[model samples]
Target chain A: MPKIAVVTSAFFIASLISVPMGPTSVHLLLPGIVGVLLGPAAFLSIAVGLILQCFLFQFGGITALGANALMMGVPALICAALFRVLQNGDRRRVVWSGALAGGLGTALAAIFLALFLATAGDNFFAVAKLALAAHVPVVIIETLVSAMVVSFLFRVKPELLSLPRREDAVAVKEKLEAEAKESESSS
Target chain B: MNTALSWPESLLVLAVLLAPLLLPLLYFILYRRGRREGLVAPIVSLAEMAGGDSFFHRWHTGLKVGCLLITCFLFVTLRTIPGCLAGLAIAALAVTVSGLSWRRSLARLAAMSGFLTLLIVMLPFSGVMQADEKSFSLAFLPAALPLRLSGLHTASLIVFKAMAIALLMEPMLATASLAATLRGFRQIGVPVALTQMILLCHRYIFVFQQEAARMWRGMRVRGFTARGDWASLTAIGNFLGMLFVSSFERTQRVYEAMLCRGFTGEMPEIGSEPIKRHDIGKAVFWLILAVAPLVAERFLHDFTQFFHK
Candidate 1:
């Protein structure tokens, strides 16, 4: 539960990091990374963030809050599933899968946004298409960014990804034994 | 040959389009200046909005939230342009009664301006023109292209409806502190776990944002600019990885502290006073306001029927 809180905080912080996209800078939602980290809890985290965004910045209005939540939250959940399927034992494969899930998560979100707008009526088809088209670059950037982040975490902390590595377990056991021996000797 | 708007017409269109964006900017300046001169204490955080002794703040949050939700749904149900205009008026009245400023109300509208503008601009061009509908063309545009007048009406109605609901949101949710608001949600049947998560996340967002800012400054000093290139993406990835790594470590420490302090996976309830009779009366008042648009639209329906006869 505390992990949920901390990961939610990280999600917000990631959004603060704006990656330049042409003349304008765009904040990466980082939903994919969040999904991979939090698994099913990603929806809860995204909903919390959206609720805060609605109240604090008023980006998504209250009436549309549920719709916004559904759009983003659903994508994050899907990203979690995608990550699970894409990941294998190979470190390089883990990075690729994470990157793919990140990019696909964004693409799916754009689709959801389009679908939400299209619900307005047939008159919104063009606008929906435009919105979807606009997100293409975002998807690319998020994929690249997620790939790098995943690789870095893989190197520094394999535990985050719950990698099944015998070496890491042995290292932890050895360290614990060393600590135990030292405490016993001192006593 | 395509018919085109004269300079005056084009300018008028531009002015009409820019009004939503510009009006907010205008009032934002005046509001800030007034705040600086002590019109009211400047907002430190969104939760602080519940601090004032206004009627909205004093009212039962559950009732307030329920009424506002109903009001928003009613706003969406308004079909006619005049009906939506009335809805907007009701929203304005609500804002005034709640003692919120033009800055806040207009800021809500501004947040929605981009999408609303897109809908307004594209709907006319996107939809098929009926025989009764009117359309006009601009110079250099294809003759086959038509801008349906009916589409414009629906689009603007959407704009008015959206504005009405957006304007009401702050007074609805922000009239109570975060805890009280969540408690209201709890009263209205939001799950306890969800509320706890929301409260926890909201608190941690502020903490982590400061840490992120500090780290971002360090990166800036090292000459990192988000150029959207490969190097920048790699740097941002590493940065996020580091942040998450720290967060995971913090998670363990935070959990340990909570466990040590006797956490049982349940947060104590954020207590709220029982709903008063006057709170019910206020709810009824809001209910009436919510139905006002529907009633007016009915009257409009009859008047049009009579005129057509």
Candidate 2:
């Protein structure tokens, strides 16, 4: 649970560092990155981000929050699964797979948004279509951004991208603690 | 407020009257030389307002949460312009009565203007045309365009409904402390774990934003200008990766500190007074009044029709 809290917080913070890209500010909505890092916990992480986005930024609405969560979460789960399947130990493989997952996650979210809007009534069909079309550029941009991020992590901290098993985290923590104790005694 | 204007004219009047509410946004945009709080002002102000000794702050958190949820429901179902206006007025009244500045609420509405503008632009051309209505065609477009005045009406209704909901949120959120509000969620049968996680996640956002600002300053001092080129992208990517790494280490340290302090997985419940009968009565009364427009739209349709006539 503590680890969960940390990972969610990190992702939430990382998503906030928006850069001015032309007229629009682009922040990393790393649902795909989070999905890959956290796997099944992707849904929870995405939900937390969406909730904060709602209250803090008013990006998504309270009424559509559940719908937004499902939209982003489903794709996140898919991307996480895809990342695992497509990943090997190769750097290029990691980047390409990450890029694919990132782009597809956004595309899937757009589809979900369209579906939600479509459900409102026939009158929303045009808005739905326009919304989906609007996300095409986002897909491309997320692909590039995710690729860069994946490449960076691959070079710097590969361990962070590894699937986090509960037993593994516990074992790792225990080992680190033991090592720290031994170092202190020697010193 | 003009009774003699047609529906569209009324909308135009409303838009004109509401235009000045967007000046803060314009000031924020063009000047870009102000406080530049970036969402913190509202969060901090709301938190401070939550501690105020007002009627709303004194209301049972559960009742406020319940009514907020109901208002969200009513927002979606509301179809008529009058209903939306009534809902908007109710929200405005709530904000005024609670003694919170209307600026944040207005700013929120302004924040949504871009999307609303998009809706206005796109929706008018997308609707299926009625047989009785004349279609407007553009020389630049194919003959299949379904552009009609009715689509504008639907789009406008959506815009108004959204504004009403957004206006209502400021009061709903500020009425109680965030923890108390989450506790209200727990009282209403929303999972305690989920609410707790939201609270934790929300807390760290402020922490991270502060970190991010410092990091941005470091970059800016080193002359990092954002551009649509590879260099800018790479710099941002590196910054993000660095943020994540530091945040991850911080998280571990935080967890260790919590463990040292005998941390449990459960969040300690904040002390809250039990709901009194009078509180329940007040909640019921306000909630009924909140939904009065909806009831009017439904059961009292004939009465509204008499006015329309």
Candidate 3:
């Protein structure tokens, strides 16, 4: 849970970095990678971060906050599930899965954003269309960037790539303690 | 009333329609240099102004959160132009009474101008015409794309509602410390775990932002400036991955240290005052203000008819 919180914090910092997309630039959302790493906790992490941004920072108004959270968070959960189902840990497979999840996640977020705007009525159709069109560059960048991160993690820490189960986390900690005692006695 | 306009007259109407939106959009860019635009950095010090003994500062936090939050939702539901205007008036009054600076409310308005301006521009031409609705067509431009007045009406409602809620955000949120605000949320039935996550994430956000700044400086020193290219994206990808790896690795130590200090899920309260009778009165006052727009949305046509009679 603390790890989830920490990752949420890091996501804020990561999103501050702007990437040029043709004439306009966008900060990285990376919710796809966040979903892969945090799994079910991604939505919670995303929502909490958004609430802070909305109310405290006032970056987005209160009404749009709920829409924005669903826009980013729902796609993240979907991408996480998709990646988990397809992941086999092969180097090639990880990269491809990561890329697919990243692009699809952002595309889904854009679609969700458009849909949310459409709730105002058919009058918003054009604005919705423009919103979807604006996200084209974001989808492209996320695909390449997500693939890079997945492959890098596959080399650096293979275990972190697969979702870390709670039971396994506790078990591993106890195991480390037991091993330390054994080594102390042997030495 | 065959008020068909000539080409020049049509152009004048279009300019009048667009001027309100374009002027502010221009001002936000030219005057402020778009201070809040494109930046995801948290404005942490915003709540520092809560220390002043304003009416909102004295209000009960839990009730404030609940009432104003409900009010924000109601503000957006207004369909009638008159109702939306009424909501904005009430919101502006609330801001004045709350004793927060108008500048803060202006900042909130600035954040949403770009998207709202886009809506204002596109809605009229794109909206499908309905019975009992009005539209205008340019003399020279294609007759196929008549600008729907209903679309303009809806777009105006969105703009007014959004601005009202944006203006209200300062009085709603900045009147109390963030911890108090979360506690208020929790009191209003937001889950404990959820509130905890918000508080925890907020705390660590400052810490991590500093760390990222340090890392960014190192990257800059190594001649890795961010730009609109593959190299910058790749560098950012690497930077993010490194952050995750480091954050994950430190968690074990972090957890153990937490456990040693008897870390529990329950957090201490932010020390709020007990709700008074007048606090409930103030809350009731806000509830009425919030509900007025909805009432107008439901009956404003009939209301206008009665007045006409």
Candidate 4:
């Protein structure tokens, strides 16, 4: 339970520290990509990064840390998974996926905040409704911001469109080539 | 004494009026000359400088929490009009004396508070303007519910006023804490991931602004002035679409780099000290300074009533 508290605290802090409006919104994509590239371990690392942020910056409240981490971190993980699925697909699709993920992540965070507030003894439905309504403008703003970050990355570094190359791909190719050479020698 | 406005209410109004003017004066006197340090540092320093060792020695975490709780209680009970103004003043003073320069601290506070005030003032007006009213097409008209403006029911008006004030307070508090977090992080050794995130976001703000500018140029070039709704939507959509694509690619690369650097499961700390005694003392002193006006206002109200009687 203590470990959970610490983990949640770290996650919450990282999420909040990254929450401010800036170029870091793109960083939201990092966790997801990292997760896809490196697996679940990346998610834990991202959470740690987020927690470190909270500790250093006090961006998110200690009480609400768990929710914040899940809110931001979950989307990042989802985006990374989606990126992996579409790694071999068109760049346009990748861009759209990222945009959707970014927008959804922000909207989800707002919703989570509302839910957390409600459960913490505030008027649940009313707070949720108000929070949802209030966040429309913010979501729209973030969506646009997210989209821009995606496009900027696309223009400058197209290679970033793909996941980091897996070592298995090269190894498999080399093994196939060696097999072919052995067959030719036997014949 | 007329029961129309509470003592806290009147004090809050005065604080609202005075904070803008007083904070700037505080900033100019203490922080304007400091070249290297940012705005918040000087005000905090001044607070410590003013109170000396006593300010630094007394450290009670509970007191700081208590002050915050009191501020929140005042907010919920009194609503935004008075409670928020008072809270803002207190928070500003607290921040100023927390070892930050007056200029940076005041500027930070003012920017945050000012944005909140503007949003509160504008939201209602904007809502009213955007409302599907047959009359008064101007966006400047009030958008408040009819039950609020009828002036016939005094109690209803009070309730409406209180609700509006409370609504205003929530966002203001959020913004204040957000600013504090940003400042606090910089003071401590910020983590690499966090720092990277902030830098990327900051950079993209300029990137988006440039995108908007280019869209405007395109509009001008095509002989399509932004005079109509169609043009406005076109310009906005184009800019948004372009921005999304760019940011997506950026994230992909940032991730690849993180993986290369052995970013395993946690952001290792670069090391940071806990809040210093002086910082806490300064925070408390300013907290008291913020509350002083409220106490004074209560006394003044009684004094005025007694003299008048």
Candidate 5:
């Protein structure tokens, strides 16, 4: 229960801190940063964060919430996976990986947005193209921000990056100990 | 070939289509610059209003949510101007039935004015093959830039569809407690664990926001202001790192506390009333009301065809 509460709270609070990008309604959606920090749990966090955004902030509608979640959550999950594969504990490597993940996530989301719009009909193809074009600056901005956030976390709290591995080791250890105790009792 | 709109038409388009969305931007700027109220004001306000007692508040969360879902489908798929207008009227009717003020509902639309404004301004110029006759090629511009009238019409339609749903959301979302709403989601076949997580996440968001704000304030006192430099970026990054470290440790403690209280893998269900028959009836009635525009559009189109015959 506490695990559920804390993970949910961290991501939700993270999303609540959205900074509106100048004249446009496009706000900073920090899915990449959340993904880098939360690891495998990034998808769940993104989905929950989006739901909160839909209901509270009116950032997206309830009906389209699932599509929005899929768009944002998939990138976060991919970012988490990429971080795990790419990082070798070097600060520069982690920063680069974070930047890549952040930019990639936004780009994929823009594509997803276009695809959703395209589903409206053939006439929306142009609008979809424009949407993707508009997100280019967002991609760059997110890359910079994600890099900073990931680098900072790596330097200050390297443990966050390796949480999944740590948990897996603990679980394996617990299973091994239990198996050994059972064998001894049988003997 | 004649695509140019006179000055009067351009002005009319700007006034009728583009102006209303600016009000919310004004509100957003005032809020951001004035009280420094932090970012959670909108979230907090909607959450508070969801607990209000009204007709909508009386309906079961599941029923209201179900209706909202249907309305979304209907509005998003709707293609005609009259259909979209009908959808907006239905949304307004729902808001009235919920006993919420039009002003409050409009304010909800206002929150999204920024987004709507963007669509109105950008979609016409998105480079879709414009219907030549319908293009609003402005004569006033030296280059005679053609604003695709069809694109503008589509953008307007999309905005109206969005506004209709946006207005309807207040009744659907704000009319119940968050717990019941989550429970409704669960009842509607969403995983129990997922709903539980959403609730937990919502509670923690407030917790973490306060902590983050305090830390931010502390940094400010120490002369930290974000600038476009590596130092500023690094400082911001460190702040985020510290926040994660502190929060991660807190999660461990929170978990330990839960275990001490005899928590297992599953959360205990929060109390909610069973769905009554009337709840189902109410949901169906509202569903019909919400989808009336689609039906009206189909009938109206056929009706017009019969006249031509």
Candidate 6:
């Protein structure tokens, strides 16, 4: 099991650096994308990368590291799940999924932040409203970016698309089929 | 003790203003200390590409978005009834003409308007309760401390104060966040190639989401639903793993393709034309506009004191 401290720190750094940008937003998206394709292990890798960025750049506040991590990480996880559900050969679907995921992810982060602020005795509704408002444009920008990237992937490397899905399924299928064929031949 | 403003009031105002500036500094100095260990080789080409005009355009868009929030805060604080009405009209117009999906916008507008109205209505009620003249003391607190206030007026004052503080803080925070990101990038010596890669990654999030959605619809048609079993969990696991691998591989291929196109590490420079003297003058003009009211209010009270003497 990965240490909670490491994961928390990684999330803190990623949120600080990633949350400010319009498109090409980083942090949880990277880990989320990684986790989607690479399994839960990828979370650790991305988390490490985030930790690196945070320490070097001082982007996100340490006090809010756990909250930040949960914000970005949870969304990334959702996006990954969405990617799985929406995985198809169609380019448009990929784009839409990515866009929706980006927007939803951002909104979720904003809500989480708002709630955190509220619990801290900041006016809950006001803070949440502000966060949601600030994130609207960001979600739009991220959506566009997500669509473009997914489209690009579809065009160039179709095999990479199948890798994560293929890892567990294809192997089992092939092995099972091979065993069946061997038994038939013996019979 | 001789200051024109009471000490507590001054302290409150200072605390509100200082929050934005101090928060980022704290983030940088303390939180960033442990982040340097995973520094990868800076991808120079990616950085160069990201430095281009397109990248800056995105940054500019972000700045404008920040400005919009500031405008909202200002509108809330400078609550001239006409201004508020005008803002409501504009929001209505935006709802009608934005050419985007109306459902979300309408929902947001309704929520915001409702909240504002609620706050407005509740103020008088709260005010009545808090206006009682009373003296109270908590353990370990000074017994002579006076805490007299009208609830409604105080609530109204707080609402306006919060709006004012937000107006002042929003832009500052946006600028600080942006500057910090840029400075951090520069300081860490991120390679141009990596910068470009990062930008591309940012861009593709939207792209892949659409792709994912289509895939999901197809799966739904094929009768795949999670009914809380091991199979569902496995299916979910596979889906996530696949998305990540695909995205990463796609990024690698993108780099390869860029290499084939004679990609250099320099992004095209993009900025609004050099700041015109008029623009600077206008900015200065706004700064004065923002400060003038407060300054006048201060001096007018002093002038009244002098005349009375």
Alpha-carbon deviation at A72 in model 4, angstroms: 2.9
lDDT of 6 by residue, B1-309 (tens): 111335666465335433334433444454335653221111111121223232122333333333333444444453232333334444344333323333332222222233333444333222212233432232323444322223223334444433333222222222223333333343335444433333343344334544444554565677776443445433433443344445455556665676787756544433432434554454454344444434444445553342222
What DockQ does every candidate get? 0.43, 0.40, 0.47, 0.07, 0.36, 0.04
User: How much lDDT does candidate 5 score?
Assistant: 0.73
The TM-scores, one per candidate, come to: 0.87, 0.84, 0.85, 0.41, 0.84, 0.36
Q: Compute the DockQ of candidate 5.
A: 0.36
TM-score evaluated only on chain B, model 6 = 0.39
- Who wins the DockQ comparison? 3
Top candidate by TM-score: 1
Give lDDT: candidate 5, residue B66: 72
Clashes of each: 0, 0, 0, 50, 2, 67
TM-score, cand. 5? 0.84
Off by over 4 Å in 5: A1-5, A18-27, A118-126, A163-187, B1-3, B23-42, B101-107, B127-133, B142-144, B302-309
- The residue pairs in collision within model 2 are none
lDDT of 1 by residue, B1-309 (tens): 223666576567556645556645665676545533111112235575677767788889888877887888888887777788889888888778777656676766766787777777777678655564556663334658655656667778888898888888878877778888888878888788877777787787777777677777788788876675788878888988988988888778888888888888987664548988999998898798789878988876764342222
Rank list by DockQ: 3, 1, 2, 5, 4, 6
For candidate 1, lDDT tens digit of each residue in A127-178? Answer: 8998899789899889998999999988888767767555766788899999
Q: Stretches of candidate 6 above 4 Å error?
A: A1-187, B1-202, B226-233, B264-266, B270-272, B281-309
Instruction: Write candidate 3's Cα lDDT for B1-309 as tens digits.
Output: 023568898888677556546635654565566464322354555566788787788889999989998998888777777888899999999899888877667766766777777877788778666655566777866777777766676678778898888888888778987778778888899988877777777777777777777787788789875676878777877777887787787666666787788877566665666889999999999898789888867865775342222
Kindly report which residue stretches of model 2 are placed more than 4 angstroms away from their true locations once superposed: A163-187, B1-45, B134-147, B302-309
lDDT of 6 by residue, A19-115 (tens): 2232333333343333333334444444444433332332232223456667666666776777768766566776566556656766666777667
lDDT of 4 by residue, A33-135 (tens): 3343233444554555444343222334333346767865666667667656654534576566655655665676677767765564321344356657766
lDDT of each: 0.77, 0.74, 0.77, 0.41, 0.73, 0.41
Question: Each candidate's root-mean-square deviation in Å?
Answer: 6.1, 7.2, 6.1, 12.5, 6.8, 17.2
